[model samples]
Target: MFKIIDLNTLGLGQEFPENIYFVLRGWMDSNNIIIKGDPNVIIDTSYCKSEKETESIFSFCGMKPDDLDMIVNTHNHADHTGGNNKLQLLSGAKIAMHEYDAHYVNLWDESGLNLDFSDWELPKFSVDNILTDGDILSFPPFDFKVIHSPGHSGGNIVLYDSKYEPLLSGETILNGDFGSVHCFREGNRALFDLRDSIKRLAQLPIRLILPAHGGPITNPQKCIDDCLRRINILIKEPIKMGYHFIRRWFIHAVLIRGEMEREKLFSHVSEIENFYAINKRYIKINNKDLFNEIVDDFIERGVLVDRDNRLSVINP
Candidate 1:
């Protein structure tokens, strides 16, 4: 089930004024920030399942559907932009996102990203504006500087405000851990880009971080630093990172079903479109080649045994 956290209970204090309302929804606690001002703006709508909840939130803030002027999507992920069509239709708001992600948002299934958007009921929507790095989006009371931060997903962006010091960090950086970049796409899991994006964000004098998931982060610098440290470790120990990724899903699959046929496991993965669980890490396989390689590595490590076309967890 999902829940909502108003501005007052978020513990942001006076730093975040009454104008900003963070709507937390879904199992992952995806956040949709509603800024109350002239030409009200909404950052990242949650999944379609949370549409009603999102509407109620707007009403609670004394806002009608037509009150919203703009809808900005941080990325093309289904969870982030699932409610775009609904909100846009209701509010007649102009939807804006990076040009690179614009097509993906419209033709998600055909993007070959290996993601399952069936459950989310993602609707096709056209991008009203194409945003680029260094573009300043001026919507009364706030001026957001778009910072192109890829790696988690191609075309991912972070909105920064110099004076306000609140970074609308999409999935680039979270409170404790960073967003997952191991998905199947050309530039989705570019490790070098992820490192560069994090480094770039670390240089900013950010006071608060309003991420897509989790609560608002007051210690922005430390969070970025911690993420950088982890990324550095992954860069140095590539094999270890691969093993870590494989083990997480391997254990999850075995624990849930006790034993799984090799073909059945592969079929299940195709259906879900990723290895990670809902609301958990976002690591995913981009293709069958990588999937087989990971499985072979697990077998060689004696963590999993493949016998009679079935894969099972090795007893300790």
Candidate 2:
């Protein structure tokens, strides 16, 4: 079971055992944690929806935004890096992200309907450090190596904290479902990269898997294997309708298609002519399940809405 932690203005340190606090977003329950170390470190920041809301996460960590010494981003998605500028200004902490994903973090292009960038301007921050696979951070009371898991994004980094045998995985592994791999549609190579990255981590002696979204897992290898199987299946099936259809469907049917009763949406889905072609193609290969699964995952994240039987995207 999951629990929610509320915060005061300055912060409620020691509320979480060992000074570890989960900063969760109420929308979808997507959470990031603050590890109070020699100098406290934040795993990731919530979407840059607004400063007032985002900064509250710091208080939950038992510290203010300015108290953080380091801010680590697992990838470049806006949700993970949105509050970066605000946090930096308050905490004066150095921001770190995988070198490969730094460009997206630095410059967010709006051509794509990626909602992570909606309602907020890209914050500026210096990459005080870079993390690569096998690189270990030995900050007192916590020591972990960086595992480069590139399927979700080219530069995705999962911090393996040995002290607790836990991983601070940004978007790599989330409660048995995988992170959004379609974000890197420009290169199919990233899909394969993600497979390899998961396989590599499966070999490690990991215990708990912590993610920026969803719940955590006590069994790392099993979760990795499940994600691997899903990726493998997607590869063999081939997205027959092409990437454009898949992207549009995600944005429309899943995001903008206002909420209704779940049963109503499912029953009447066949009537939506705009998605007929893609749906038919997926149905042929039994890939329709995958499409629905992704939609359900987003719904769980509060990124997708299902009201009554209608569906739509939640306005950030």
User: Each prediction's Cα lDDT score?
Assistant: 0.71, 0.62
Candidate 1 RMSD computed on C-alpha atoms after optimal superposition onto the true structure? 7.3
Task: List, residue by residue over 41-155, the lDDT tens digit for candidate 1.
Answer: 8899876666777777787677887799999999877678778889899989999999788766656554532245222346677788899999998865678899999877778
Question: Which one wins on TM-score?
Answer: 1
TM-score of each: 0.74, 0.70
lDDT of 2 by residue, 1-316 (tens): 1244332221322222456665655332236777776778877776555456766656655677777898888876665776778888887898888777765545544423243322233455556677777887765566768888887767888887655566777767776756655533426676688788778777766666677776556667788888878777777765632343354345544332346556555545544432444445443433456457656776787776766545677732
Clashes of 2: 17
Candidate 1's C-alpha runs over 4 A off are: 1-14, 106-109, 112-120, 239-267, 270-273, 276-316
lDDT score of residue 315 within candidate 2: 39
